[model samples]
Target: MSVELTPGLILILGALPVPLLWGRVRSIYLLALPVLAFALMLDTPNGVFGQLELFGLQLTTARVDGLSRFFGYAFVVAALLGAIYALHLKDTVQHVAGLVYAGSALGAVFAGDLLTLFLFWELISLASVFLIWASRTPQAYRAGMRYLVVQIGSGLLLLLGLLLHFHETGSLAFGHIGLESPGGVLIFFAFGIKCAFPLLHNWLQDAYPEGTVTGTVLLSAFTTKVAVYALARGYAGTELLVPIGAVMTAFPIFYAVIENDLRRVLAYSLNNQLGFMVVGIGIGTELAMNGAVAHAFADIVFKALLFMAMGAVLFRVGTVKGSELGGLYKSMPWTTGFCIVGAASISAFPLFSGFVTKSMVMSAAMEQDRFWVWIVLLFASAGVFHHAGIKIPYFAFFGHDSGKRCREAPLNMLIAMGLAAALCIGIGSLPEFFYALLPFQSEYHPYSPDHVTAQVQLLFWSALAFAILMRTGIYPPELLSTNLDFDWFYRRLGRSAAGAVGRFAARIWQAFAGAAAAQTSRIVEKLGSHYGSGGIPARMTQTSSMVFWTTVLLAAYLLLSYF
Candidate 1:
């Protein structure tokens, strides 16, 4: 309780000695950082601390309130889970990067000023990229680079917007910054990029699957959630986000349904889930805000569980492609069961985490008369069940037998997944305790007859539809082929277009150079004809001609001077 340091610093600083410590000492040290941070987070009271003034501007580095407190708890818990999940690895880079990344996210959450937020915001990207690169594959390398560019670009946009906002308003406070000014709009897009806004979301799917197995789990828990927290803090009630979030929710279902890579499917699913939170933030009502925050917390748990499950498959069988995986339950029964739990949670099954949290946003939309938004969310919910709820578990664990036999996930991974599954069930089964931690007070019930009945029916019909599609051979088959998304515009199409233009430009340059070279050669030849060893100037009369010309020039100068 007497600890003066914020929890974020504790984790970040504690990671310093990780590389030097080895064996059980290192593992203990790694696990203790998160535990200590969590304890410090819980002990810290609600208030602002670590205020400073620089260049005549006030800054609050640590702001503890309901919103920050909620995110902080989730982030710290994620770090602890990640640490446990990664405990068996000898990869110190991952451990350090994961800790620092989680700490940076917490730093961003607690930041009370835009400047402080920006500082932590950029650090998150720098630290998390190592997770992707840790895979040590060329594909992972390229993905990490692209992911870094987008993430750092987001930070730069945030920085530029905050600076402009400071100049216009003479304040850097992190509060409602609706899209009324250029600065606010820039800031909005910056948050949108991180939130996986429609056209700006390719990075999430592109990079997350490329990370090391445990790395992907850590990556899933931080960046977007912090972006969500930032949006809730600064851009809440911005109506434009409603439609944007709706688009986010709807489109990824199409991609996820056909995505061959199971991890990539989850990545798309992550984008879909974020849409619910984004919609809640956009609604800006107390209930909507509560829904957004609550869903984020639940999502961190369930999503991680799902990713951990797939990660385990990737670990044991060396692949997560649905086309190549089946009958895995016999080998990894615990993992299979956990993956199903995750699927149910994400699909919003009654009495699951997603059901309890996601419904709040839908209810808020309905209350706000956002008829279309509510409808799209409903469709998205079903679509998620179709792909994520059934597809992930079915193909990976129960579909056509791939005859791939392997050991279950490591003890650490099983422990981590079990804890996450427990949290999902716990939060869903006992809503009051989790609801109490929400930013706003609410009496909303997630288990009322209407809510329960509708959710169950939606899930049931979604599952039935999936069965019919599979039975009738109408479902999209998972194939080991690339599925293009918005990134194709830049990654393939844009690159090709640029290459064409570059070639055209290069051809024009070559033509010009050739013509210039030809002309220069002609000029040089002509000069050689006149002035070379065999030319007139080289002949015996050259000295006389030169002297005559000099005499004529002298005579003309003398005549002009006399005149």
Candidate 2:
């Protein structure tokens, strides 16, 4: 295969002509970009391309390798699924945004240098927020703004970290940035923020639920997964991520159980899923990294399947709130079944996508003798069954009938959901295929007796617990209200502090302005007195001030040039 050009550019440049095409041409253009990009990614040989010296530092814009090829497949698959899902929409802006967002992610995955990574880092952040804005509601607008701030803030950290790294190491390479220096630490948190690390995760919950239905499904696929890739690429073997990932896997389940918004619940679920991958990356073994990459791939498919199902409900019934939804199985039975499949896959039921992938991470943890972390992961596994596996389907489909009836999801949405569901089952049932695609060879068999029995027992126990809790009326009821997460620290407290700073700055500015006005008045009076008809050369001085400053600037420039 010829490596003629950078593959990420296919989507990036292909998106430029989107809005110009009319009717079916635009649709074909949108759908073809992902396919072309995926083909290019598959065809490109393993080597660095687009190397250049910028300011005496080498930059590699395209680095095609095994790891990058894996993520490239993920990005293009996501975009293709998203494109098929969005085929009916006439919104070229949204299509353009999706393409640019996907392309930027691809670019980042293949980036061989820190500066190149940062370039696509900012672009992905900028391009993705439009998915939120496409919702076109005041809430979506505000949430999109907040999402952008957090995302761009991550990009800023990356830029500063890269600059400091260049200064410290005199290299721009983007690999193995261990957290032994200030720059590396900044870069870690930068990836951490995008990866939805515990304190930095509220953006996912706050904004994903607020995005357009299709937009949310697409949103589910990128960003955080990219962060996971970045972590695996640069921070592997960094021991701190082990505990961090453990905390991530465990905490979000509690929030998921309580979250009334189904999509927000999924958002929490996403954070939990990321924790498993992060743990694998931190372990930094071949099997563990394979687990992380494999889980990421399966996760994108099944998670997006779940989101697409809920998005169907959102599109048809105008709500995905647990309080407002029930007995959807009667109307949207296909969506109900798809949602169940996704729920099962995410819950790691035997023969589901997650079952094949998630176990590798936990096994890797056990291999590293991370006994407590493995215990936490075990507990998290059960908790996911309770919240995501059971609660999601039970509340949304089988709870008390909410008396809301609507048409099924549109045809395009169904096809998209079906395709994603098929992939989830295909990957789960045929683990050998995906295992071969992993960055390392693995002999981890998920269907071994101990593995299947343990998973089945875990599911049974978790289901029993949920049943008892519900029967005893101890379970929390879904209500029409928002739950606060870590974002409160900033959204409430930070906003107040910012308001205070703005007021203080305004007062200072007003004082300075008044004083300046007074000083100007006196100066004008003095000048008027001097520049009166009998005064000496004051009028000429006013006219000559501009010329004088220009000549002074010229003289300074000449002196610097001479020096």
Candidate 3:
């Protein structure tokens, strides 16, 4: 097939130098790059752009199918918002890294083949790490290292799985996979790790809160969303994902409720949202897939909006812990209001983005006769409101009157948040615009009486329970302690276990080396006895030569008698 370069790729490549030369150009390049990329993405056709041969594999880098187009569109919007949110930062390193990170993610989603996806997957990892490191604190450095390790590790698994898959299937195309094959399972887990599936989810909570305020906004948009896209692409309809998604939905609320760090709470909330998409993927019908796609697009907007709000808090207050924050509405009313919209949207409140998109996933579950899954999802949706919707804004802005009189977020930050907030309401109010972007036709209506009434009942009751609990002093207050998560396995258990084994092996090696040395000394002494000048063998050889003549005659006589 003939290769044609899309405007998206061209704009992304052109953006590479903006950060490096940012100082010379006074950061105009930093601001312009994302806008240009967004425009380019909007211009690209919704079809495959180019195909090429690399390493004997057919690699297609820009395939703009329906599913990919949805994600790519979201990513470009995310890049634009994130750039605006991060406009206050003067650091060129972060500016460049963020642009590259966004571009690579768009590239990955649009990739037609596994090879191109894997390449961009690794590129996203490489470019995104700088955001964390830009914080320039010891904690940020440590967290960034861990984040890079996990991300790179995930990429390696993806690469391995892709290679094995290509070898077995004789195709490098990215598409649906079954658990029956090792390659498929490998790819699933690889995506799962990024998806923050159940126990593999701690890296996000650990790393995201540790990044710069601007970094957190960018961080929120890319990694897990990309993972969701991959799962939707390769593992949709895999039955195992149903329960995984269910657990993902239910478990994070407990942590988010009690967590001190606001960004970390959002991280857990992110996991919960991903669970909804995972379930939609497992259902695998056109409506369910559309729901997943629609939810993902909506999620990118609202979730980024939420992060942008919290990032603004962190940016101005110099901290984002719920414990350290309170009563910010007095000073930053606009920020607070924007945050409430985000919280409401995430809570699936009526006439918000979450209300429109998340209902599709739940409806899809019910349609598939997944009664129990639907119930669990219902509980999760309520829990989402309890934690993300109520808890984030309540603690950050209203719980206690924190005496902080800080200024509102920078103009760029406000513009970014306002843009995201607008999109959140826009998508929610006009569901058709989002529905049209879905990969499949949407036969399910979100505005039906049954859906609306059920959702209202669930959300209102959840809210009532939260209020009663809080009023009666039953709800847990946010504390300044780190909650144990999946990272504990690597951070505590894995590290301790590896250290113990290492020490044990070192001791055994030391003893073995000492014993070998002693034995070698004995062997050298025995050799010396036979070969040294003072030894019996040396003297015997010298003396034997003089007696050789006499001994030869006696030996000859004895031999003659014997004959």
Which residue runs does candidate 2 get wrong by more than 4 Å? 1-3, 506-563
Q: 553 in model 2: Cα distance from truth in Å?
A: 32
TM value for model 2: 0.91
TM-score of each: 0.91, 0.91, 0.90
State the lDDT of candidate 1 residue by residue for 1-563, as single tens digits.
36545578888888898999999999889989888888887888998888889899899888899999999999988898889999999998999999899999999999989999999999999999999999999999999999999999999999999999999899998988889999998898888899999999999999999999999999999999999999999989988889889999999989998899999999999999999999999999999999999999999999999999999999988889989999999999999999988999999888789988999999999998989999999999999998899999999999889888999999999999999998898888999899989989777888888789888998998889888988999987779999889999989999899999999999999999999999999999999988887786577486887897899899999999997
- Pairs that clash in candidate 1: none
State the lDDT of candidate 2 residue by residue for 337-448, as single tens digits.
9999999999999888999999999999898888999999999999988889998898888888998888888888899889988888988898988888787766888889
lDDT: worst 10-residue window of model 1 = 1-10
- Score candidate 1 by TM-score against the native: 0.91
Which candidate would rank higher by TM-score, 1 or 3? 1
Lowest lDDT 10-mer window, candidate 2? 533-542
* Per-residue alpha-carbon lDDT of candidate 3 for residues 20-67, written as tens digits (9 for 90 to 100): 564536456666766666566667667776878877778777777788
Model 1 CA deviation exceeding 4 Å by range? 1-5, 508-563
